[model samples]
Target: MNSSYEQELCNKKLETILVIDDSPTNLEILHDVLGSAGYEVLVEMDGASGIEQVEGNPPDLILLDVMMPKIDGFETCRRLQANPSTKHIPIIFITALTEAEEKVKGLALGAVDYITKPFEQEEVLARISLHLKLRKLNLELDKQKQELEIRVAERTSELSQTLNELKQTQLQLVQTEKISSLGQLVAGVAHEVNNPIGFISTNLHYANQYIEDLLILVRLFQKNCSNPGSEVEEQIEAMDLKHIDKDLPKLMSSMKLGTDTIKGIMQSLRNFSRSDGENKKLVDIHEGIEATLMILQHRLKAYPKRPAIQVVKDYSVLPKVQCYPGQLNQVFMNLLANAIDVLEESMIENQYLNRKESTFINPKIRIATTINKYQVIVKIADNGKGMSESVINEIFQPFFTTKPEGKGTGLGLSISYQIITENHGGNLQCISSPGEGTEFLIQIPF
Candidate 1:
């Protein structure tokens, strides 16, 4: 427990009692009686001294003598009551006056109760015990109220934080959906343009070859002819010899290559934009994994002296799951991309320490899929630097990412979590440790 809390408990355990009287015998009796009852007793000889003591260090209860030299009990009680700081302390008057008016006056002066001269010991003890219990109860009540207020404030703070996080996650999801829709439209346009491009590319290739042959024939004719016959001149003239033959052929060849490259790009776009729906089909998960691998091929390839990490597929024979294939493909894409990022960070760290000469040994990514009686499970495991216990615990929380700013939006796992749990009625979980690599297990109902 915190030191402040422990200190509070100790303070609560001790209760102080203040006894005010002019007579030494009376003060001694009050102190001894209260002290035996487990209260710390403070004694004052006169009303003036008692008021000072109460103001300086307030006690839980005060026992005051009504009659005293110089400053009297009524004036002291009035002083204590006037100040808000010491006003609430329970005060009982001890007096020798036996008249009804004297008792009435003491009670009117804010004394809670009165004890006449030659006080009964049992009665004095009983009244003190009763008032002390009441004081302690009041203190407990105040403490409880303060504690309740603190708890309410803390809960409100947590709820506000959660609400803010939810709003941010919603905004990111909207942006991602918009981008995905745009990608689909671009893919469709690219696919439609591919057919015309293919035809144009083929035509350009054939035209270039024809142009080359005509150029060779013209050169041969020119070399062979001197002051040639009219038939040869007619033939050269008919072939349009004055035209820029070399330039035209080169232009057509360049156009062909350009169109062919565009066609390939379009094909890649089409594959990437494939949609997921409620349509259930027999899908080979391995094919989707391979497609995702191809999409990220550039990232996997090493540059300069860096060694590329190998991807190992260990797919088990399993029944096809009845679910949206495209979404599953996206899950694979995200997992593989995250693994690549971790591995890249490791490689960069190694390079920073002048260790670039050392080659990475068996830096690999493994993906496996299997089907049980009720569910199909896909496990994507990576052998990159793993997460600690804290990271692993909060990995699925929305907008929680280990990647640096601008490198990640931190919504991939959050969205993936929503998709698996809400959309598909499945579960997504992670198994990881510090040195041991992480594995995400995704289970979809059959």
Candidate 2:
């Protein structure tokens, strides 16, 4: 009994061969040979017990007798093969009825092979070993397939997470760029404001002293000699009274002009940087474009290439359009800045090729605004070397640029496109051909 229990436990890890035969001689002979060959063997005298044992604990191989009480080996094989759990276990039929049809019948009932009544111990072991090895290979393949599926799933999930992180990083980078640009704008505004303020401050100081001196002169005339002609007149001439009378109003007027310039700068800044506006408001698109132009004026001056880039504006009387003013300003900034960069690059290329403005074409950026009843169309055209179709097609895709690395972020056109189409429900289209220059048409509903 201890030996039997130990064998059963070993069979859990090793191959356990089940043999069913009604003949004691056949069963004993087969069990002894299989057990000697290092197989864990279980024997049943009848087919019924074999089926019962199969249901309880399936085996690696089944050896059966065709003749039996209650259930024959063929019937037993059929029953085992029909079961979902035991269907794959190899079944071998052993019988004394060696007629061709009887062997064929036994094999037909789901038997993998047939053993004659005087079966060789070697043949049975060889077949059982082959089938068991095949089963082992199949199980290993199943395990590997499952492992591969798990790996693919994990890899897919990781890629998805990585894509999300990259998108978030891109968004943060855009926000940082916007903040940096705004900081630069603020600095420029401060410098522009300080200029007029400085001159106005100095002029106002001199004007204050001049007015005080004039008041003293009036008091003297009232108190002492309101009609003392020659001496008072000589004193007034010595004070240069005629010059003060003429220049004092002019100085005050210049101070007022300085204040007016400061006021215009402030207004432009407010229009360009509508940071608090959330909902759409009626805004003059021309105002936004001009505000952006003022911000980028320093880049417009004459460079080494030729003269200053001439800005030709052909604006029609446009009614205010409802839109997000700040975002619209951003689009204008991007497009105008892009035009400037392209024109600069084209000029440099011409210089490299020893082609001057006389040989090539003069650089110009033309802005034309017109309006239909429902929409305002602003066309910004530049007379520089244009782009090929390939370049123009992908101009609005993020991270697409021909500019040298670090010189351009490549997000300008993409962001501008989004702001126009997605944010404002407007359209932005580009028209270009090689050597023919480029133009951007912007349309927004009024």
C-alpha RMSD by candidate, in order: 14.7, 13.4
Residue range with the least summed lDDT across 10 consecutive positions in model 1: 268-277
lDDT of 2 by residue, 134-237 (tens): 87887789899999999999999999889857855684468447845775687677678777677777777787678868767775775787677898789888
What's the lDDT of the predicted structure labeled candidate 1? 0.78
Best by TM-score: 1
Listed per model in order, the count of residue pairs whose N, CA or C atoms clash below 3 Å is: 0, 0
- Give the per-residue lDDT digits (tens) of candidate 1, residues 1-446: 57776677567666787888889998888777766656689999898889989989999889888889988988999889989999889898888888999888877877788877799878988888788788778879989999999999999999989997776579457535844784678676876796788778777778778888988987787788777889868976897666665476667767877887677566544554466645666666666676677778888887666677788777888776666566666677778899988887777766676664644455788888888888888898888778999998888877789988888877778777776776679999999887688899999897
Question: Model 1: what TM-score?
Answer: 0.55
Name the top lDDT candidate.
2
Q: List the residue pairs that clash in candidate 1.
A: none
Q: Once all C-alphas are superposed, what RMSD does model 2 give against the true structure?
A: 13.4
